[model samples]
Target: MDWTRQTRFSDPGRHHERLAALRGDVAAIGGVVRNLTVHYRASGIDFPPSRLAEIDTRWVSRMLDLDHERFGGAPLDTPRPIEQRLVGCCRDAALLTVAALRAHGVPARSRVGFAGYLVPNFHVDHVIAEYHDGSRWIGVDPGVDLSDVPLTPAGLHTAAQTWRAMRRGEIDPSTYGVGPDHEIGGPWLILDYLTRELAHRMGDELLLWDLFGEGIPYSRMEWSELPTELPDDLTHLDEIADLLIAADAGDDAAEQKLGARYAEDSRLHPGATVFCASPRGARYAVELASVNQEAD
Candidate 1:
């Protein structure tokens, strides 16, 4: 139920057990319409997709039957933001899929970003569910409604679709057709690790580590960089690290310039860093806090 973990997916065994349960639960739901709402409430995870799916699939469906009619319907004729349409559709699908997985006892989360391939600059969105399947985190894409939308993971609108392919042991992340969005770096790397680990559990060859391409650039000298010997308590170390990176990158002004986008990610130790060699040594480091904080 509480999928959050400080260790993330460090333990593979627990991940697998939970994932299998979720798969079975989702499969039991049977149909698109029923799976979204009633099935979601029965499942039990508390998140956006779950809550949203309950409303749309159950309340909204009863009132409107959006799944049969609204989904895949023509875009609004009046001039409006495409972002709104993309987010609305993807959000609905994600909530439905997430609710199904969580109902079955699998810890899952929803992810959204540009489709990166076919849509190019446009956001061709999709949702992927992350669940722990005992040994590791697994990914599933319930968004692939094969009867109506023939999913080709190789095409540009592929993130959500390819996620399903990965679940079916049909594809790998790097080759999943669409390029990743700009922000799917470390935090996402951890997220994908969970997703890919689940894929591996299903006798799938896909591995998250293998998919790390010229991933988003990471600065090698963030302030939070800690000594390899982590502290037993692991307290203010994270905050300290954040400050260090902000300082090293130079001054409050510089840190401010980088903004929350980098601030949220810049998870590294002040003294050490991880560089992606294949991506030509893109470096990443932690942030800084105060001087008294322990480096570890």
Candidate 2:
């Protein structure tokens, strides 16, 4: 896939001008994009219920709209207090970073997975932007202060990597999830994110909470809708995880095979609408659209 091309989710639209000012600085851009859960706890800031819903703003243009509306066309370097920033999740940070990088003619895309840096022994589901630096893809965590630094294991632990590890019994799937306290991690979650990693790799870069696969047994509308038991396809998911891992390891043949598999399988790519189980609140179906035309 062309990582440089803007997906509908990453296209800056009318706010295209704003991205130019950021100069493709992922770390600085991440600052202006407030993570909903992180900033709230750090600042102890109470917010309107509607404000929380901003997590569902999937389009980069819409996010920029909110940013401009709040800050009045300020440059991304200009620090906005936590309260004034657009409330979102790690996915927002990654999407905006990818958008900014793509704006400056850099090839970038978001990667979805679990992170071990958040909680000790727990891999929190996370997203980060990856830019193709001529020869290879580099991961950058805009949501953190790791500026211009290469992502190590302490940072983003890809779901594909973790999935393979779980399969080998090298790590427990239960330790990888939403948070330490939240009841959201398990092998099922890992199974879910494996599809997410594939989708991101395919350039869809959908939200982390968006489900995949066919029907209730293999997929659900949201985390709340998940079945108590694991999907009856651990063996199937393991095969997918193996392909994804091999591709990431720079196997040219594996990349070719994985790309073909993803294209042939509808489950690896989201359709016209994503069933959003917004962490902020509420569950709804989101119609997918790319920026074929500039916004109003």
Off by over 4 Å in 2: 25-43, 147-153, 216-225, 290-296
TM-score of model number 1: 0.28
Please provide TM-scores, in order, for all candidate models, with all chains considered together. Answer: 0.28, 0.86
lDDT of 1 by residue, 209-280 (tens): 223212322222222342333224422333333342343333666345333323343332111222211121
Each candidate's clash count? 48, 0
Model 1, position 149: C-alpha lDDT score: 25
Give candidate 1's error at residue 226 in angstroms: 39
**Model 2: worst 10 consecutive residues (lDDT sum):** 34-43
Measured with C-alpha atoms, the lDDT of residue 86 in candidate 1 is 20
